[model samples]
Target: MAEADPMKGVVARLDELVAIRPRAGGGFAPGGKVRTHQLGGHRSGFRGRGMEFDEVRAYQPGDDIRTIDWRVTARTGRAHTKLFQEERERPVLVLADARAAMRFGTRGCFKSVLAAQAAAILSWVGIAGGDRVGGVVIGPAGVATFRPERSRRRILSFVKSIADATADAPRAGEPPLAAAIAHIRALARPGSLIFLVSDFFDLDDHAVREVERLALQSHVTNLFVFDPLEAALPGAGSFPVTDGRIVARLDVDRPAARAVYAQRFQARRDAVERMSRERGMTFLPLDTGQNPVDILHPERLGAKPSAAARSAR
Candidate 1:
């Protein structure tokens, strides 16, 4: 099959993403509709701790009897009713990595591109559900901020700015993962939903600790995008590397070199997954080679195999 253009893929996928609506609940239901309450915003009212029952008035003609506060009515000697306070809008932040290192793609597309796509989808989802959506794109130039807004246009603008900002970066870099995490911690308030997108290749223990701290204050979703080739280098012959003037060919066929690189990659991935689990975050493993929409909409992949079926493999 002919490879699709990356830019074209992004545009097409964005269009498809706009069409998706959350199910009746916030989760994706069988019918691709999310329950209204689950959409994650103020429309559902505040359902959490801050919510209080306002004074009940006489039962309105249409008021549900279930909501009547009988004890209040008995004490007041009137048909006083209960009114629960509604919730405020929940903020959702998409913390995306657009570092140079994320620009490499041995197979599929670049991790940076995938991160952008994921951010776009997530931002749109949050906005659609009536939540305030904002984010920061971390690249070599530093963190680019997009304050949370409910407008669809704002979400689109955020996604586009991220794409434009990272377009000029080199395909690799020593990203400041720790600094970015700290930035997120400062920017986001408690109880926000944070979607952290990255290859998570350069993150050190300090960065991971920062992420953990953020997790304590917010619900986090870690989306790890990587190329399969990055995990396992093919048994190809030595490949030539040119540093403009100098040309050097390094043999990857050597078992030691191959093993070391593979181990490092695997270890990084494992650490990321473990951290996510420990922090009670949802960890999604995505391959850049796969369709972006499919990754976001996993149900489209088909019925998930049962544990027995998966284990048999």
Candidate 2:
């Protein structure tokens, strides 16, 4: 029998990721100790096609007859149209980084694989919460975008796009993060939530500016994924590592080198945190060694019951 393709196991899996949907009940679960309650679904803080009635206004020439406020019209003896603030369907777009730099992993999976998994989980959560789900995958070749929509077909299409785009690693000459942000900035309108999942290795000034622009119009969330080793190397002598380009041995036994390595990763993470805080975006630092589900839904783990579960109790 031929040996199995390691990429298949390591890169991305739609089925398993989608299975985590039921875990996504409510709120914006992040790295912080406390919970975050974000409005979506019925609580979505947007005005659009919804069932809830906002007010009644004088009937305009183009007003739909189906939306006539009969009670108000009969009482006031004037034509009025029911203005309903449709509980807006929140749109969530996942940006996955699958460039060459993401191919390396020391533990559970490569950075790119973790990215795909994180995207899938986000997609499923959005779908579960009655939100429009879509994504953009930034691979070596280029980028693939799927329009956000609330339908089984669209959700499946987004998942398939993510899987296909990240199936094989590609080499991107320029910094893919900036381009990905540009795509998101163009697509994002008000009432949209954008999730950017990456190791954030070499984020430049251009990307930070774009993120700020995006935050101005919509909610921006950063899911920074990194290998544990990248954060801190154990004092276990030389460690082999690669970023798909350079294969080198890192001297973990050297305290000075380890401190510098840890500081480098910490600085990148701090940058993301600072940016997110200043602009009111949610930032979650994901460890490759940790479970994605746990990062997304920490309330479900161990002895703690979910908020809903706690309420029922």
Candidate 3:
């Protein structure tokens, strides 16, 4: 088989993504560290905290003091405790960005492909954890939304939607990132876990507010995906860049230009991080050069896997 062109990594194939299912398991965790390229760790406090009242029974040893049922104890004339069970099917939403800006990369694969791959891996992990998986893919054509479902079939369908979104052509007058965030705010239920994978090029004031609102109801993890070139210029020289429609010359040779470019990128990152920090959400930076599977793995993220993690893999 011929190797695919790295320059033309425009779309993500369904079969290719499906093959990643097996590798998606083992040590992966949403709050895992990406210990490479100076990309630090992320923290997540969100869990299946949604508990339902099971019953009230006589208090026994090891019963939580917080769960003590005072009314039941008073009526029964004995110490009682309320038992609760965690919700089994917590909804997990993977929001992937497949806009035109994501179609460019200098290593591994395009940002769009990386976003889809990450989203697919997260979806598989969610399903494996006995949670419902769904997603929203913001493509050049528009947005595609899938409701959360616990079935593998539903996850596969959602994966296909993400793959398909990458192949769509850029359309004018399409909905912005804020619109998609707004859509997710409406679609997501309280306590839902949302993984937002994007380069965040379109994240503006409106999108920031929208994300803030979304974070209030759901646990949002911002996976900021970017290519190495976007963060810094390769050495110092003139380079040609294009935005699908127009081509322009980028003079990285000028120190002022390089400084400005780096500052802009840092500003964008700082803004996203600020939003995440304010909302108590997780903010992770993903380089296109890094493997999505390794990045998500709890114990193997850019590090030597432990014996237990190796056995699981």
Q: What do the candidate models score in CA lDDT, each in turn?
A: 0.65, 0.68, 0.72
lDDT of 2 by residue, 249-275 (tens): 876677888889889988998898778
- Encode model 1's per-residue lDDT on 1-313: one tens digit a residue: 9985645432224443344433333432111222334533342221123367645567655355677789988988877657554445457788878776776664455677777777776776666566778888788777778778878788877776777655654544544888877877777765566778898877797988888887654566677888887888779697775433578986787888889989998999888877866655656678777766664555553424233212211
Q: Residue by residue across 23-121, what tens digits does model 3's lDDT show?
A: 323322332322222111212223222356656767765455787889988888999877654433347788889988888887888899999998888
* lDDT score for residue 207 of model 3: 95
TM-score of candidate 2 on Cα atoms, chains taken together: 0.72
TM-score of each: 0.69, 0.72, 0.74
Q: What's the residue-level lDDT of 258 in candidate 1?
A: 86
Better of 2 and 3 by lDDT: 3
Clashes of 2: 4
Which residue pairs clash in candidate 3? none
Q: Is candidate 1 or candidate 2 better by TM-score?
A: 2
TM-score of 3: 0.74
Kindly report which residue pairs in candidate 2 clash with one another: 49-86, 50-86, 50-87, 140-170
